[model samples]
Target: MHQHDRKIRTIGLADVSEPGDEALITPEVSAALATATDIVGYAPYVTRVQPRDGLTLHPSDNRVELQRAGEALRLAAEGRHVVVVSSGDPGVFAMASAVFEALEDAPQWQDLSIRVLPGVTAMLAAAASAGAPLGHDFCAINLSDNLKPWPLIEKRLRLAAEADFAIAMYNPRSASRPDGFARTLEILKEAGCGERIVIFARAVSTPDQRIETVELRDARPDMADMRTLVIVGNSATRRVGRWVYAPRQVR
Candidate 1:
């Protein structure tokens, strides 16, 4: 393991709800972190998933946070193995983009050995547990207006509803983001039929996990939070007891 010491390793995003939830980290990522001593990951909770705590690397002038991430990148570039970690899938709305963006701004890190590992995104894990709600064409949209505007997100929702595609919604709700959920439901209702299925997956892969199915008209905003992953089914979606399935191979 020490032979790989000088390499720069980025651990995949993982849900930290519990040891069981750690399955969000893929096998390749597990191997990458096996020998890493210095690991930086997105804080487990949505409340802590910000740029201040090294959980994510993003455009910020916060002196303290910038200094810390700069040092980490510097160390890795200087031949010290450092891990940049994220929660859920880094490729999704996670830290990979931030890390690379920061590195791009600092050309000194261009020469460093950079590797991004893959992890199970919360939506996938949640969908798996609730049968296969994403067995067909699906779209993922983040409702956070921090980087992108609410109008753009709403437009995307309208398009998804119009296509009648299975949808995976991220950052559905947060303390600061109260209206995105309601707006999403309204748009979906306008574009799609009331018979559409909606699946709410909260605290996925953790002991406190909850999954439920509701009609498009009945989906509520109150039950959602940052940790929740919502899956909206097309007209063909069906629910049977605790399971929701989308027919893939209809003969």
Candidate 2:
């Protein structure tokens, strides 16, 4: 469709998904973004929904949030190949929508090339490393109270526990959102069996990553955060050396 027979290349963006960690960006992602003349990444709130440093903001919001939105808009208007990096899969709790939402009014982005490549979501990586924690049906919920009300999150946690479904917890704790995950754990412990296996997996596939298995009643509030993944085993979950496995053993 090029009258000059020239290809219009856009920027390739990779999901960063984690704070203070770089392993989330794989070689495949680098190669794609490398092709661009310039690449820009935006990290979402891992623990508490906030922005990071080096990003500017639009005055009315947090500096980090403002900077992230402003940068993408600026690059897009310049007609440069702009790739917005987000943590985890862009589609999951990442920046896919935040980028689009910020630029929705600016139709200039309409013709610009935009692509979102899939990356490792924290939950998936955690579940994999924690054995078969997700081998059966499960649910994932973020425990941040910034956007959603605590009541809603609490309700979901209660429902997940009562249903006896294995659950994955994301954004479980943060400096400001401290009590979200702790409260959820309490609800789960009361609704589910005391012996339920709770796998605390942190920084999966990263240098500081640590994974542990404990009982639902044993999980401490001080032990988790937005960077951690809390896998609450259904009644059948079991622990296997730095990992948790939920089996389908037919009786």
Candidate 3:
């Protein structure tokens, strides 16, 4: 038997918990790292994986998800066990979908074995730190217009507001697109969400973490950056002893 055929080169997608929070690493993810021949991902996430003698880390710039996914697939095809790392759960606004998208475009990669090991997503972590503001009905929306159109985002935001769902926003503001979040806040105000509670959870689970809650009317675009997770509570969301939560009952 060929040496390559003797070992299976399955590609593993590993998710890491927020920075400075080692306790959140799942057992499965920790186990997978022991066998990873190569780890691929954005620089920040890839840096989280400890360097070992046999492991090779390939860190790339942000916004190159497709290229990164393709590189991981190619490495796996070469009989190397590879892990594509993401900050949160791989499936939630992360590398899992990008890898699948790359696979779809390259039918030759369809047979490659791939597994997504889940982790605690950012919103959930943020919600937990804020005392369950998402206890009631809620929806998560990516506010980045890089892939989707702005009108579609606006439409969804308006509809979500109309439905009275708590809105968990990802990629709310970045240096490149500072104005988008400002517009988002304006739209929410127009939707009569001004008095609602808004939480900006920045760098959650990290040493520099900061969680701030304010009324939507008082929220400013400057309060959030790319690293922040912005959560807008529904009509009934309230604060109790420095924590915000949505009461289970209506009326």
Give the TM-scores of the predictions, in the order they appear: 0.84, 0.77, 0.92
What does candidate 2's lDDT look like per residue over 1-251, in tens digits?
A: 43212112222222223443455566665665554433444323322123334332222223254356556666655644445555677767655666666657666555555566777777777887778888877888877777788899888888887877888887788888777777787787678557898888887776777888888788898788656878888888877666678787623
Candidate 2 versus truth, CA RMSD in Å, comes to 5.7
Query: Ten residues in a row with the worst lDDT in model 3?
Result: 5-14
Question: Which portions of model 1 show Cα errors greater than 4 Å?
Answer: 1-6, 16-20, 43-71, 249-251
Candidate 3 Cα errors over 4 Å, as ranges: 1-18
Question: How does candidate 3 score on lDDT?
Answer: 0.85
Each prediction's whole-model lDDT (CA): 0.71, 0.64, 0.85
Q: Which structure among the candidates has the greatest TM-score?
A: 3
* Candidate 3 positional error at 118, Å: 0.9
What does candidate 1's lDDT look like per residue over 1-251, in tens digits?
A: 44354556655547723333654666777665555545554333222222333233322332233344565577676666666666667678766666677777898667666777777777888889799999988899988888898899989988887776799988889888898898888888888657788888888887888887889898889878867889998778887777898888543
Extract clashing residue pairs from model 2. Answer: 16-86, 16-87, 17-87, 17-88, 56-66, 56-67, 57-66, 57-67
Better of 1 and 3 by lDDT: 3
Q: Name the weakest run of 10 consecutive residues (lDDT summed) in model 2.
A: 3-12
Per-residue lDDT of candidate 3, residues 123-168 (tens digit): 8888988999999999999999999999999999999999999999
Which order, best to worst by lDDT?
Answer: 3, 1, 2
State which candidate has the highest lDDT. 3
Model 1 clashing residue pairs (backbone): 13-86
